[model samples]
Each structure stands twice: as C-alpha cells, then as structure tokens.
Target: MSAGVELDHVTVRFGEFTAVDNATLDIKGGEFFSFLGPSGCGKTTILRTVSGFLDPSEGMVKIGGQNMTGIGPNKRPTALIFQNLALFPLMTVAENITYGLRVRGVDKTARTKKANELLDLIALPGQGDKLMSELSGGQKQRVAIARALAVQPKVLLLDEPLSALDLKLRQHMRSELRSIQRMVGITFIYITHDQGEALTMSDRIAVMSDGVIQQVADGKAVYDDPATSFVASFVGENNPFVGIITRADSSYAVVDTLFGTLRGRNPKGLKVGDKAILFVRPESAKLGTGAADTTFSSKVKSVAFEGNMTHVFLEGVGKKDVTITVGRHSSADIPAQDEIASVTYDVDLGLVLPEGKMARE
Candidate 1:
C-alpha cells in the first residue's frame, strides 16, 4: 500500500525567514528515501510539510498523484514517527501497538490480534502483554515502529527516530528499519542529520543546505562524485587544496597549489584561471608512490592508528591539514611524527570543483 510523494516547487516560510526554499522532489513508492542535512537546513521543515503539520507557503504537496492541499495529517495516508517515541507510560506493549486501532473503536479481540501480528513483524512476537517500561531501548523502538505501522500508512515519515539510542543500538536499528521497510513495502521518508544513518539506510539521499538541496543520488555517487564543494566537504573527510586552475578539459583539470600542480577530475567544469579546490579523500591517497598524478613531500604531523587502516596527518602540503589513509597490512612503512613522507594520489580519485562556500565554512 505504498504511495509516491512529491514536492512541486515547495517553499515553507515562518514569518520573514524562509525555512524551506523552493524545492521539487519526487519520491517513488516503496523506496526508502532520506532527507539529510545539518540542523536548521530545511530538511525537517520539508518533513513536517509532507506530514501535514505545516503547509508550504508556496507550491504543492502531493501523495499518490493527489494534491494534498488543505488536507490535515489525520486525513492523509501518512504516519510520522518523531525522535521521541512518545509511547504511553502505563500502556502495555500490545496496548501501545494497537492504540490507533483502539482510537478508531476496534474491538479488544481484533486489536490484540493486530498487535501480535505487528509484534511479529517487528521481531518482538509474544511480548505484547508486557508493560512498555519492561522493554529495552531497542525493543521500545520496535514497538513504536509497530504502533506506526499498525495504522497501515502508505507513507511513513521518520524524524531522527534512532538518534536517541546508543551508537551500537543505533547501528542495529538502521538494519532493522531497512529490513522492516522492505518487508512491509511502504514508502519511508526519513529525515536525519547523521550522514552514516542516511548512507546506511537510504535508497536515495537528498543532501540539503541553506534550504536548498545540493545533490540527490545514491551513497556512492554522493561520496565519490559530489556536485558541489559543500557536498565534497560534508559527506566525508577530504583534503582540500585551494588554487587556480592551470589547465582544464572535460575529464580533467590541473590546479596550481602550494605544493605544485595537481591534477584531478574536472567535475564542476572549471576553466583555466578559475579559483578551484581539488578534493582528495584519505583512502585515495597513497604513501611513497611516484606513479600518481600528484606527489608532494610532507612532514607527518600525527597519525591515528585505526584497526585495518591508519590515518596519517600531513603538514607542509595543501595549506591545511592533509590526511592520507594507508592499509595497516601494507608493505610500506608507517610514518611517525616529524618524519618526512611522500604523498601521492590518482588524479581520477580527486574531485576538482569551483571555489565556493564550503559546508564547514
């Protein structure tokens, strides 16, 4: 019973401040879509608009090809799960799961049957009779999900529902949520500021900033081929080398940096003489490789020993903190503090973008 959702030229404003700028997006039914961004970046605003808690100042909100103009949340075929689970303290697990059915005047027998079915769906079968306080954090989360799903909403909107759990539990819930979505075949519209959560669960991600969507793509495309400088810096750890482009073409660009000329993919189509930033991921950087398109001698400032991979911080290059990641099992020697090291990276792995406002800046 999943339904498609669409925002056509949507804009939400609170008084003079525009919370969500003009944004048009189409979300396919049964797809796990996520809206990811920093706080106050209009992601939650869009979610609220879709949930019918707030109407857009301009444009249209549609679900299943029907315009949702002047529609209240209760009338819409959607269920929203907030960050706080908001379960009734005195209610039993079955009572919480069947609250919506009870509100609609379903008989106790039918409600209990529906509750047990949902408990089984959430992998918490046979635990319905227990009080809500008896369940653990992860278990309570599942009960909340079952409560929402019990209403059979075509579109389920979640706003950072897993942010309350511990790191391990949060990770566990990510898989659990995805599995539940696949099993129920409902369209899940998730809103989150956590990059890992979005990347781990979403079929497609819309990265928002300043009330605008910077990019909408799968996890790999968003991380590897960012369309903007903000996306390049926000999605992952990147070493940025700011300089003027010396050469440019459809596929590649060379930038004159502090270390020397560095070559990378010309994704933003910057021309020669344009100010640009070349982004190199730590994993794409190698140590002591002369075959790379860019090579610079750097002094090791520090090294973080992570299992399986070591992050080597380099100074005297790129005019900022440059990091290089190397496999711990590599035959190359790990550099120590103050040790002079040679850093190299393939040109294609570097994303060259026109100089613009960065996410951190």
Candidate 2:
C-alpha cells in the first residue's frame, strides 16, 4: 500500500556545513511530489534522509505515520532509483529487474513471473530477455524504474533518473513516469534541478535555494503567483524593473523605476520607499496597446522568430534589455531592429516583489 512521508524540522550537517536546514513538509500518499533546486542547495540531502541512506542531524523522518529515526534503507518500505541507475551490465533485462527479489531469496520461478509482470507494467513487454547493453537510454531508464517497482515499495525516490536521456526522450519519459506512478498508486518523491521535469510531473513542488525552501505550491501557483523574487525570476524568463516603491495600497504597488512609474499587484505589501522589483513576463507585454494598465517605449535591438511567437529584445528605460513576446496570430505590429516600439501590459499580470536573493543561472 502507498504511504505518506513527512519531515519534521529536518536538518542535516556534514562536518560543520549544514546541508539541509530545518526543512518541514509532508508528501501525501499516492501523490507525486518533487524537490527542485540548483546543485548544492540540499534537495538531494532531503531525499537521502527520507530514503534512510542518511539520518537527519536533527528532527524526524516519518513514513505512514511511523518514525524512521532508527531505520536503515534496506529495512525501509521504500526504493531509491539513483541517478546512475546502477543496473548490472552483465544481466539481462529480466535478470536486472528480478535482482532484488533474488537477493531476498525468492524462488527463481516467482522472480521470473514478477519480472514479466513488471516488464508489461513498464511498457517493455517481451523485451525482458534482451541484455542491458541492447537497450536504449530511455529503455534503460524504464528498466531501472521497473526494477524499483518490482519491490512494490510504498514510496519511490528518484534522483534525476531522466538526466541521461536526450531532450525528446526525456520529455517522453516524463509522461511515462507519471503514468507508471499512477498505475502503481504509490508516493513518488522526485529530486530534480530541471524545472520542466518538476513542473510537468509534480502534483506539488517545493522550490529550494541556499538550503532553504523558498516556496511550496502547485506548478501554476509557483509560476503565476511567486511568493519571492527568487521564485519569480527562477521559474521562468522575466524582465525585471528594479526601483523603489513610490506608492502602495492593499491591492497595488507603484514603483518609480528607470522606465517611469509601473504599477503591479502588491502581494508582498511593500511600503513606499522600499526597494522592489517588478517582474513582467515576456508574454505579458503587448505591443502598441493604448488600453493597457501601463505603457512604456522601447528601442528594438533584436528580433528572434520562434515559429509560434517572436521574441523582441529592446533597450528601454534601463541598462538591461527588455524582452517582449508577440504571438504570430496577434494583430500587433512586428517591428524591425533599430525601430522604436511601445509595449504595454495589464497591472494584474505584473508581479512586484521586495528585492531579495535571486537564482543564479
């Protein structure tokens, strides 16, 4: 049966360096949860703690409401699919999938039967007799997942298992993974730095930075309503206008920036004179719209056509370049380089945030 996982004020230390710092959260049973962050930001540390490979220096780890403080990974009702996969090259696909059952001394006939069932479960039916060397990268990934599932783990922990596949295959495997998780009806704890992977697969995401979780929410919430400047800039492409708040009310904040006054939603409740940044997504800015909530002029520096849309980079009222995305189907006029253009956007789509640490690319 599937089980919920929880971390209560978890902290992990390596010598004097704190890897994970007081992280507290819950992963619902049968839910797909992801921990997303840049490298060295302690995302993997939490996964390790939950997997029982490492114990937290402080606090508790629980699965199915049972404390996991003294448990070893082998004894826990969980399976970890490592980034390297760790499949035996000499073993056939079925042999690899049944390796765990073999280690537990399950009969060969039973192991083989279970392996065949898993082969069908992973959409690799009739390919179990093939050697590991004969499988493609994506095939190997599925085999690894099948092996993990062979144990019928209550919680499955994956650490960037898709990192080795090409772009198209990785995208395909994301769907496959999600489908497999649903079929098994188990809690999935995925660790990844790839935003696309997390956003596409997770029921909820925990965005982390510098050993701290910046925000935890559904993908749309994290993207459309970021709780921090770091989240706003990191989740997607954004044009930032750094300035001091000129006026603020319960619903809106107006900032006096190099590009003149700009108003946006005031979810952060910034006061006048407070340093803030207004983050407007490229698609949020429209070309030559007089009916918009805010209007600004920019000198077009470059244009890159991307089939469905064109990205226009401009030199506006600041040192940094501003980018606006124009959909091909829109009635807005596309401009040539060196031409002046007016851009406008609604205030509600713009996100104003108090200046804080942003993610480094």
Candidate 3:
C-alpha cells in the first residue's frame, strides 16, 4: 500500500553548510511527486532525508502519519533506487530481483515465485534465467525497478535512474516508469535536473533553487504561472525584458522597457516605479504588429530551422537577444538575417514580475 510523506520545517546541515533550508511539504499517498532543480540545489539531500538515509537537522519527518525521527533507511517502509542501479553482474535476472527476499531468509521456492511474479510485473516474463550482462540497457533498467519492487515498498525513491540512457530510451522509460508507478500504487519521490522528465512524469513538481523551495505546483502551473523570477527563468525558455513599472492596476501593468512601453499581467502586484521584468515565451511572441498590446521591431540576428519549427533571434531589443519561435507552416514568412521583424505579444500572455535573481544558463 502507498503512504503519504510529510516534511515539517525540515532543515538539513552538514557542519556549517546548510543543504536544505526549512522546507515544508506534504506529498500525497500514491502520487508521483518530483523534485526538480539544477545541480547542487539540495534536491538529493531532501530525498535522502525522507528515505531516512540522512536525518533533518531540525523539524520532523513523517510517513503515513508516523514520526520517523530515529528510524534508519532499512527500518523505514521505503526503498531507494540509486543512479548506478548496483545490480550484481554474476547473478541471473531472477536472482537479482529476489536478492532482498533471499537476505530475509525466504525459502528458495518462495523467492523463485516472487521473482517470477515481479518479472511478469515489469514485463520480462520468462526471461528470469538470463544473466544480467545479457540484457540491454533499457531491459536492465526494468530489472532494476523489478528488484526494488520485490520487497513491496510503500514509497520508492529514484535518484535520476534514467540519466545514463540515450535521449530516445530516456523518453521511452519516462512513460514506462509512470505506468509502473500507477500499477503498483506506491508513492514515488523522483529527483531529476531534467525539466522534461519531471514535467512529463510527475503529478506535481517542486521547483528548488539555492537550498530553497521556490515553488510547488503542477507542471502546467509551474510552466505557465511561475511564482518567482528564478522559477520563471528556470522552468522553461523565456525572453526577459528589464524595465520600470510606469502604471499598475489589479490585473495588468505597463513597463517602460528599452524597446518601448509594454503591458503584461501583473501577477506580483508591483506598484508604479517598481523595478520589474516582463517575461514572454518565445512561442507566445508572434512576428507581427497587429492585435497585440506589446509590439516592437528589431533586426533579425539569425534564423535556424529545426524541421518542424524555426528559431529567429532578434537583437537590439534588450541587453540580451530575444528569440521567437515560428511554426513550420509560417516559416515561409520568416524574415532574412539583417532584416527588421515586428514582434508582438498579447498583454494576457506576458507576465510582469519583480526583478530578482534569474537562472544561469
């Protein structure tokens, strides 16, 4: 059965270095929750804390409403799947899957039955006798998951298990993992730096940065309505225009940017004279001046066609070059390099946020 996890005011410190800073989160039972951030953002530390591999310096860790302060990883009702997998090379697939059961003194017949059942569960039926060295990378990944599931853990922690796979295999395993999680009905706490992996697999994602939880929301909300400049810049590609707020209201604000006066949704409710940045997605900005609240013309620096979509880089709009994505159907209308192109975006689509630290590429 699945169990909920709770971290109340959790903080972890190694000597003087604080890795996780007072993070509070409630993860639902049987939910696929992901911790997403760049490297060294303390996501792995938080995962270790929940799995009882590391204790929090302050606050409480609870699983299924039971306090886990003094519990060890082996005692907790959880299992961890490391990035390296750590499978035994000499063992058969069946032996590797039932290693945990064998260590617990389970009889040979019972262990064999369990291993065969798990092989079927992971879609490797009748292949249990094959050596670990004989399986493909993707097949080995499934066997690793099967081994973790052998002990019937209520919560499974994955530390970038698919990072070593190729792009095609990684994408394929994303769906496979989600399907397996649903079938088992266990809480999955996944740690990953890849935005695509988290967004595609998670029911909810917690965006972390600099040992802080920046925002916790679903993938769509995190992508469309970011709570901070760090999240807006980190979660996806965006064109940021630095400016000062000239006018403000409840829903919208006008900013005096280098390009010109532009309007966008004022999500942070910044007042007039406040320093701000207007962020617009490349896809939201169209190559035209008609029917858009914000419009500007700039010289096209370059254009690259990637089959289905075209990327047009515009210069002289701001300190950084602005990117616009043109669809394949509209690629014929794309302006040549050195030619001027009019860029426009609707007020509802753009977001005006307080100026703060932006994510480094």
The TM-scores of all predictions, comma-separated, are: 0.95, 0.96, 0.96
- Between prediction 1 and prediction 2, the one with superior lDDT is 2
Give each model's whole-structure lDDT.
Answer: 0.90, 0.91, 0.92
- What's the residue-level lDDT of 113 in candidate 3? 94
Better of 2 and 3 by lDDT: 3
Poorly placed runs, candidate 2 (over 4 Å): 289-293, 316-320
Please provide the root mean square deviation of candidate 2 (C-alpha atoms, Å).
Answer: 1.6
Highest-scoring model, lDDT: 3
At residue 71, give the lDDT of candidate 1: 99
lDDT of 3 by residue, 224-337 (tens): 999988999999889988899999998999889888888999988999999999999998888988544599778999999999899999995545789999887873489999
Residues 94-127 of candidate 2: C-alpha lDDT, one tens digit per residue = 9999988988999999998999899988878999
- Candidate 1 lDDT tens digits, 149-252: 99999999999999999999999999999999999999999999899999999999999998999899998889999888888888888888889999999999
State candidate 1's TM-score.
Answer: 0.95
Count clashes in each candidate, considering only residues at least 3 apart in sequence or on different chains: 0, 0, 0
Candidate 1, lDDT over the whole model: 0.90
